[model samples]
Target: MRLKNCHNFKDFRKLAESRLPGPIFNYIDGGADDEVTYRNNTSCFDKCDLIPNVLRGVESVDMSVTVMGQKLDLPVYCSPTALQRLFHHKGERAVAAASEKYGTMFGVSSLGTVAMEEIREKHKNPQVFQFYFHKDRGLNRAMLERAKAAGVEVLMLTVDSITGGNRERDLRTGFSIPMQLTLGGMMQFAMKPMWGINYVTHEKFRLPQLESHVDMSGGATSIGRYFTEMLDPTMNWDDVAELAEFWDGEFCLKGIMSGADAKLAADAGCTGVILSNHGGRQLDGSSTAFNQLTEVVEAAGDRLDVMMDGGVQRGTQVLKALSLGAKAVGLGRYYLFPLAAAGQAGVERALGQMRAEIERDMKLMGVTSLDQLTRSNLRFR
Candidate 1:
């Protein structure tokens, strides 16, 4: 199927599966052990019901929202993931242009294939730098400085991934950086000949974000090693607080789950907290972001901008999050699969479908503006 046929997350996912090698596709699609949290991330929305009101004239809907000092025309923004160029030749470039067109924020992972400076120079919309704390303090500071120099709007430090999760899929498939494949994985690659041809024909994949800081060339750094040996498992609130103060910019923590942690983030001067479970990639069986929204938002909603990511697929889900006081929501596979399937066009189509869904749902809910949504509109069952 092509980009035009892609109507929802699953449609784009199928297209992406057809286009990418099995090992590469699973790297993005699969999650932690048993994939429990991963599955719940999107399915949690099914537990709630949308209470819509009719007969209200929403002639034109205003979906614009401002979060962490950046204005976005839509309530959802792209969540950063690694190894983009491996999925599509355009990679982050495709997502960047689509986010720009939609006037939404787009995050670039610390392990992204594209360079932050290049992405910054190319895209005018808000850009977020998704960072990981390294054991080397100097490297951590240098990364912050580089992102600051690039004029990135938000510095989002991922707190949950001090060490990589137990992703059995990667182990079974033998997926690693620089395209190391097991015998079984090699056969899967051979089966998808078109993906192999496109991958070979396009420019070689490189993690420009970590290329200079880490020796990824010559097979020096594997993703597993990067997590096991390089990341600072000892990272604490104090270190994050100092970084927040140093950046003196729009700072956000991307993996806060509990009310206590959310309060700490607010106390530490974080402008925002993304209630996520790393898209169920980092932690298994952790509570879904949507399920914890009310508690986290109640604890820190006044002091910090509360946003969430996991399991957001439909526009009504986004509206539910907003009605409960989420500043915005994030999209991971929602856009990534589309990017992998048909590059910018696929992403735009996904965003277009989302926009229409949000608009139609908003009017049906009898709201003309985003702020009109309130807790009174929701009732948990």
Candidate 2:
């Protein structure tokens, strides 16, 4: 399938699968062991049905929302993922430009291929720097300072990934940072020569965010090693509080899945809490973000913005999360597949389709603004 034929998340995923090598595609598609939560994240939305009203005279619909001090024209923002350049040569640059066009927030991962400073200089939109708390306190402090200097609008510390998940697909394919593809994986890449040509023709692949501190040369550093060796497994609320205090801006905790943790984040001076399961990449049986949204929102929605990401593929899914009191929703694989399919243009198409879907669904729901959506309009099955 070509980009022109892609219409929705599934379509973009198909296109990406066809365009990308198996190992790379599986890296984006696979989840933790058993993959139960991965499938449930999107399916859980079906448990509750949207009860829409009619004759409300919906002429204009506003999808704008303010989460963690950033005013997003749309209710969905791009959650950061690692190593974009491997998927497509445009990398974060393409994602950043598309986000600017749509007037939404974009996040740059600590493992992102593009430099955060360069993305900040190039884009005039709200940007988030998603980083991990390192064992070395000095390294963490320096990364925060760098993001602050780059004028990053949000600081999202991923709290769930103290250790890497058991991604069996990567293990089977032998996929790593400097890809040690198995023989079968090598054959898959050979079939996709176009991807290889583009990958080599573009700027050399480097994790600009961690290159200064981590030595990833000669295939020495795998992501698993990065988590095991560099990241602090003992990170707690106190450490997060210290980081939030230092940043002293829009601070958010990205992997919070419990109401108790949500309350702690609010007390710890976090401006926002994202109820995420690392896209089901870290935990196999953890509750999907949608199922856990109401509890977290009720726990700390008043004190801090409660947002969610994972299994958000359709406009109705976004609306369902918003109706439950999410400040905003996050798009991960929803946009990444399109980026891998056709680079910047593919991303633009996906975002544009999502925007159109949201606006149309808003009118159908008989609401001109997001505030009109609440539990009153929902019924659980």
Name the top TM-score candidate: 2
State each model's CA lDDT, in order. 0.89, 0.92
TM-score of 2: 0.98
What are the candidates' C-alpha RMSDs? 1.4, 1.1
Candidate 2 structure quality by residue, lDDT tens digits, 1-381: 788899999999999999999999999999999899999999999999999999999999999998888889999989999989999999899999999999999999998999999999999999999999999999999999999999999999999988889999998897865468899999999999999999889888888888788776644455547766888889999998999999999999999999999999988999999999988899899999999988999999589999999999999999999999999999999999999999899999999999999999999999999989999889999
User: What are the per-residue Cα lDDT tens digits for candidate 1 across 104-154?
Assistant: 999999989899999999889999999899999899999999999999989
Candidate of highest lDDT: 2
Provide the lDDT at 300 for model 2.
Answer: 90
